[model samples]
Each structure stands twice: as C-alpha cells, then as structure tokens.
Target: MNGSEVQFWSFVTAALLMIIGIYAIIFMDNIIKKIIGVMLIGDGVNLVLITEGFKPGGIVPIISEKLYNQSPGIFQEFADQASYSLPFALVLTNIVIGASTLAVLLGITIKLYQHYNSLSVHEIFKEEKI
Candidate 1:
C-alpha cells in the first residue's frame, strides 16, 4: 500500500499491542504473565517510535564521505531524503533498558516462586497479609 496506509496500519497494531499488554497486566494473576505484559507494552511503544521515524522512499540517516565529496547538491538531496534518526536511537536505548528490566523481573519471579512454591499473584499476596 501507500506510505500513509502503512503508517496507519502500524499505529493500529501498536495500539492493539498496548491494549493487550494492559489487559494482561491488570487481569492476569501470574507474575510471569505480568512481566510479559510489561514487555508487550514496551514493544508497542518501540513500534510506534520506529513507525514515526519511518519515511517512505527514504534512505538511512547516514552520510558517506564519498557521497559528500561527490557533490554538495547530491549530499543535500540525500540529507533531505533521509529518515529521522532520533526515534531509532531512542528505540535502541529502550530495547536495552527493557531487556535488562525483563531480566531482573524474571529473576525476582524465580526467587518468589522458590519461596512461595506458586506463581499466582493471589497466593503471594496472601502470604504478605501479615
């Protein structure tokens, strides 16, 4: 399809992912499932950022020294047609942070399972009622 259509669909997909994640986080009763929900939300946000940065018929936001030396006009044209880099950078940073957070959450879940011998949120909360 066209550029606008592609962007529209991507945004819809991102919204759906975020909705599902929120549902899981609020309704699911397992710690691991809650962690997955958090990850899904992060992924949805990342997708939106990447989609916003996308440009149809655009090149990467990189300039080769050779291309720059070829002609100022060509360099300017390339710069004009390049996609935005900031969103990509932000997504990269987010992915790293999300992965680390997921790791820590999973580790904690494992420890909780070992202590409580169950993964249900209700079971864990009941133990903490004291």
Candidate 2:
C-alpha cells in the first residue's frame, strides 16, 4: 500500500523468481528446462532493476509544460520527483539481449536434440564418447 511496502514486496517477488530459476537450473534434467530457468533468472533480474528505480509520488522524467513553467530553476526540484529512466533503459536492453541469448540457446538445444535424439542433459552427456 505504501512505498516501502511496495518495494519490499517487489524485492520479495524478484527473489522468489530468481530462486525458482536457480532451482530449475540446478535440479531439472532437461535442457529446455534449464533454458527456461535462465530466462526466468533474466526476467527476475530485470524486475528487480525496474523496481529499484521506482519512486514514490514520482512522475515520468519528461519536461511537461507544468514543470517548465513552475519556476526558472524548478528543473532541479522536479527531478527529485521524477522516476529514473536508466533502469527502464537497462531493462529494455536486457530484454533484447535475453531474447538473443535464448534464441541461440534454443538453436543449440535443437541441434543437440537432433544429434542425440533426446533433450535430457544427463542422457546426452552419458552418450558422449569422450
């Protein structure tokens, strides 16, 4: 309900997601599951970053007419109430990179499945000659 409560919940949710992702990665035997875990981890990190930049009673960091006309030196004061844009930008970049990474991992997984006729990492490694 309040700012601190929201931040606390956001952090809790992010930590839960990251924990699930790590559990999947460490305990799941399927290559696909591992890939999904990696994606979950990425998403959790993005969530945390976005939430970290959240501001209570904040507005977008845009120079609106109201802000511009407030005072000659109002920009500095307005900045205090503006949510940071860097986290959002970083999240966007992270999403793009995560997508690319997932694509590559899926491609590799597909090839591995084709060669091994299975998606289980344990099985694949067991079949490896060397």
Candidate 3:
C-alpha cells in the first residue's frame, strides 16, 4: 500500500483501540479491566502521534556540517523528507507519563482490592462511603 493508505489504516486502528478502551471502561465491572482500558486509550493516542509524524521513505532528522557544505540545496529536500520530531518526542514523554500514571493506578487498585477483597467496581464502591 501507499503512504496515504498506510496512514489511513493506522488512524482507523487507533480509533478502534480508543473505542474499545471506552467500551471496557464503561461496561467492564473489574477495576483492573478499567485500568487496562485507560492504558489502551493512551496507546491509541500514542499510535496516532506516531502516525502523524510518519513520512513515506523518510530519513532521520539529522544534518552534518560537511553534508550541508557539500550541497547547499539539500536542506530543503532534507526538510521535506524528515519526519516530524515533535510528535515522536511528545509520544515519548507521554509514554513515560503514562507508565508512571499506570503505576499509581495499579497501586491504588491493589489497595482497593485488599480493602474490599474484590476487583469489581460495584463491590468496591457499593458502600459509596469510603
């Protein structure tokens, strides 16, 4: 497939992931499943960011002084071919943040499980007092 086709499919996949995540969050009774749903949504967002940064047959965004000196006109060409760095950078930062957030969420889940002896949201919150 061509670049556009691939990008379009990637977007479709990302949307599917997010939708499934939402479904799990709303319909699943298990707290762990809900947490996994949130993780799925984050992964979908990451996929989209990566897709947005992708360029067909792209090169790394790097330029050497010697290479630039050899060809003054190559800068524009390089710029055109170089996939965006911002999206990738954002995805990286998001991954780190997401991991930390997931850790905290799981930690909370463990405490809730211990207190209630159940992973079900309804069971944990049925009292609605804690």
TM-score of 1: 0.94
- For model 3, the stretches where C-alpha displacement exceeds 4 angstroms are none
Q: Give the range where candidate 1 is weakest over 10 consecutive residues by summed lDDT.
A: 67-76
Where's the lowest-lDDT run of ten residues in candidate 3?
121-130
Clashing pairs in 2: none
Clashes of each: 0, 0, 0
Better of 1 and 3 by lDDT: 3
What's the ranking of the predictions by lDDT, best on top?
Answer: 3, 1, 2
Residues 15-128, model 2: lDDT tens digits: 999999999999999999999999999999999999988997788887878757767587887777889889999999999999999999999999999998999889888856
TM-score result, candidate 2: 0.89
Which residue pairs collide in model 3, if any?
none
Off by over 4 Å in 2: 64-73, 127-130
Instruction: Find the candidate with the highest lDDT and give its number.
Output: 3
lDDT tens digits by residue: candidate 3, 1-130: 9999999999999999999999999999999999999999999999999999999889999899999999999999998899888999999999999999999999999998888899999988887864
Off by over 4 Å in 1: none
